[model samples]
Target: MPQRPEELVELLPAANRFLGREAEVGDPTERRGLVLVHDLAGDFDAAHAGALAGAHLLAALPHEVIARFDADSLVDYRAHRPRMTFSGDRYESFTAPEILLYALEDDAGSPFLLLHGTEPDYAWERFVAAVARLVQQLGVTSVVALQAIPMPVPHTRPVTVTAHATRRQLIEPYPVYWGEMRIPGSVSALLELRMGEAGVDALGVAAHVPHYLAQATYPAASLTLVEHLERLTGLHLPTEALREAAEAHRTEVDEQIARSTENVAVVAALEQQYDAFTAAREGTDLLSGGEVPSAEEIGAEFERFLADQDRKKPRD
Candidate 1:
């Protein structure tokens, strides 16, 4: 669907607020390059990991807020209840929604923009257009948005990422999507599409999260995103914190799988399917003689195994 003429210009006011704080943004020598956006979306809390990755970068680089969005118009207060704390005799303030634009610089002194926001419940188009306008004003050359999606893959296999971009050259290294797919829309998706239409370069990287680990914090995916960004933008970004966390999480997951033979079997089966899929994508004939299992079949078997394990567990 195309946006109305008024919707495009109406957001300029909010976007102008993004450029007004240049003094607080960063060093004048750092030239604006890319804009990284993270909208809390999908399963596996990958959005949280992406946000933490952004935060870690901000900690290492000089950064400041460029703009702030009004939560009252975008958020549903009832769904996100702010917690109140008591300190001494005074009541502490509630935790409000944080929808912010941050101006940051990398180790190479190339500046970039990072936008982190709670997925809005209202006026998504307006919010997205406002961000696009801000990107144009900031002289950002490219936009990279991060998202993590749950797939029927195993944690034992290396995490795969799907790249979407306005131009084919930007994602030449990644596998091309051939089939038509439809999923629930997100602000990040809209922003990328609108930016592309506005003649701005935009790319989206979707980290594949194992369906079973969708609810867990997977720092491995976070580390992968940081590394990919470095290669894409040629900017050195920090990933030590996420790396350490990923190693610890890997150990925990391994121990849990070791406890259950069923889990181990399921993982092994999934690993085979993953390897076959990988080989196929690489234009290999590794699975020519053997039968390649469908993702649905693998996912169904794992689900049954989990159900059986749950039923056998002692109830409280």
Candidate 2:
């Protein structure tokens, strides 16, 4: 039987035994920032972005594992069945999810903490409590959450980022979301909310992904997240890898659009709507009076167009 969340939280300190081959160095005391990159809610673009950032951060910075959370308590193993890699005819090994805490340093020797792991299936409160305590113990000045959301935007346009923070000061001078939205909750969302109530500074960066490409590995979205992090935290994180990946992915997507006139038309229509909406933001609230094309309407049109194209394809 899987352990309960609270019970799992109790085992965090000793969870290092499950990290497989990854060596865990003890925590460093100089950490100043905390970045939360929990992969839940099944948003692939956000996951991709987090992965890219994590890779660069780990490669360029000095880091050590400070804490490990119990996967038995956090993950729903039945849903995410552990995979067995085939070494030979009958040899195999189990691969399990792990939650790890790392103390990292940037170019200027500034300290930061990265909490990278799978989002738990239960015990949200317990998880938040553990993270909050870690934040306080590490003297973390700010907590930043990274995510990507499917938006009614176009790929041809600049990616838009929706910013929010527990304290207005943290996200000021950036585009803030005031519209009432009811998104499915994520671990990072709850963590930020709990931390805010406890007076810890918390900020959220949501990269706006095109509805069509939300399920794909969108490196452009990843780059946007990294840029926002650098702007907010002065991390000096490298972006060359993400940049190259983005260009390649863009070319691939462009090729797909070129295959069908319907696809090209769909993209053009989305671009038009996006440009108008963005221009309206500078003057009046175009979204309030329903004067513009509804995001749902635009998305439906895009979907219908793609479906029609699929239906016309000759099956082998």
Candidate 3:
């Protein structure tokens, strides 16, 4: 049987055992009392953005440390299972889920929780129950989940964030807007629900990134979420470095777009759709809906483009 989360934390190997690996622990006595978790899969760029933001916040808070999980420790027995109802290919790998725990130093306010990763392969409800048990063991008062959402917004504009909380009364004081659409089930969503049921405050912040740029790095979106975190948690995080990196990335993207006529044309078409959607949503409390292309649509377009390119390849 898997050990309890508290027991797992105790079992964590010391830094010395990992050689190059080291733990960045803030003042162990200060007690900032917060945790942040994020997913690190699907669209590596977006996942990278969330990870960067989480690392930056941990650095600024003075007493928070990055949560480390032993990915190798997870054991999933269903690795070779078919991917979908009609698919025959098996999954590449499978492992057990890990709960990473970090200690917040410096008497810094309530605990924050962040989660990032691709959709889980197992039961989300069970995952949430496990997280709730872990939270109780960690003595966390609140949890915050952060996610990066690819949208139709332009890269030139500042990324916007939408938030959702289990209890409106707890999060109403913050300058966050409620999510306009229904979010499907995921480990993070299940965690939030379980946290609320356990009487631990929980909220989710989703940072928007331009869909065209989802394949590329977008540190600007990361910085945007960091700013929101500072406001919500009363912790200051330095974003100057992130801003500079984002600007550099934007320049590179612009240069690449300029060089590729096909990409330029696609971007232009996307821009027109974005403009129309934005205009329709302006001057009202109603938030933009259905502006972002679904994952299926993006995948289909990409597959078709790839097929065309393959056809154009020279005969060997």
Candidate 4:
């Protein structure tokens, strides 16, 4: 027998309360409609920036779990095994993986939804359909995904991002850097694609983490993600804690890099590239000379670029 989409999730009574209370009092136009923010696919995130952002919001805001997904049916235990504490010969405790939906209140007392935790390992289509059903039932109007990717950028420079949306107008202010390319996919990416096909407003940002710090905890990237989330969703989110952590981490990283002349030289080279690009922001290309490559030149270079991007490589 095949599995049904409805079986994938269990909605709690609190979800109705979330809708019922809003329906009773708020003005129609004042409602921006609920925004569903997700940080799924743990391994896909560079430096776990998306997870950090979701965690920060949950920690800072008042929230409650409104729905739970069937993790056993979705997650592969071998890939992301749950932790077990064994004392002597007996097992004391086990930390199980879960996919949960949280209803939260931001600093301004506005309500929103967050889907956090493990991404599914199987039945992506069914999982996505289940979410779409929930979205309709919960009155969510837009979806925003939080992500981070390693880039050849410098920590000394301000963080930048690749902004994308289902509709171009949603992110008209952001620049488009790439033409067309096929890359590896994750469940979260698929969800965004399908949501757009269903005519829902979907947009997201992938903060550019310095490639050297891709495997490490980079609060700066997470902070940048939160800031973009605020601007995109019209939600007032607090970032003071993330800001403080980023500053402390920067000082620590700078001190470490200063100890190595080779590392310092590498960072200095990146800074030069970053500065050159900033000086010519109005220009189209990254080259400071302002020379646009021909179609043939771009194709050849892009082929070489594709060769360098092995998904299994140590650095992105």
Best candidate, lDDT-wise? 4
73 Cα displacement, candidate 3 (Å): 4.2
How good is model 1 by TM-score?
A: 0.77
Tens-digit per-residue lDDT, 1-316, candidate 3: 7644433233233222221221333343433344545543322234356766766655554432334443333323244222333336755553444434444332345435444333444444544555565554444456776667665566654566666778887556434423244433456667777778877778767677676665556888888777666666575457787888789988887898889899888777767776675577675432213244556654454454334434644454
lDDT of 4 by residue, 1-316 (tens): 6579889999998888756655564554444479999998455577788999999999999999999999999987776768999999899999989999999998899999999998898899999999998877777889999987666778887877778899999887777765776556778888889999999888898777777787788898889889888888889999999999999999999999999999999999888877776776755432112222234543444344334433433441
- Give the residue spans of candidate 4 off by over 4 A: 19-32, 282-316
Candidates arranged by TM-score, highest first: 4, 2, 1, 3
Which regions of candidate 1 fall more than 4 Å away from where they truly are?
A: 1-34, 39-47, 86-91, 280-316
Q: Write the per-residue lDDT of candidate 1 for residues 1-316, one digit (tens) a residue.
A: 6443234332324445345554245664453455665545322234355666666677778877767766567776665555688899999787877677776778877667777656676788877776766665566768887776665667776666767889978877765534554445677888789888988788867666676776567877777777777766677777788789889998999999999999999888878887776766675332111223345653454455345434644454
**Ranking 1 against 4 by TM-score, winner:** 4
lDDT of 4: 0.80
lDDT of 2 by residue, 1-316 (tens): 6444345543234333333212332444343334543433323234355555565667667877767788777787765556778876875787788777776767777656777766676777888887776665545657887777666667776666767789888877674444554445667889889989998778867776676775567888778777888887777677788888889988999999889999899999888887776677766432211113445653464455345434644464
lDDT (CA) per prediction? 0.66, 0.65, 0.55, 0.80
The true-versus-predicted C-alpha distance at residue 139 of model 3, in Å, is: 3.8
| Candidate 4: Cα lDDT at 302 | 35
Backbone clashes, each candidate: 1, 1, 24, 0
> What TM-score quantifies how close candidate 2 is to the native fold?
0.77
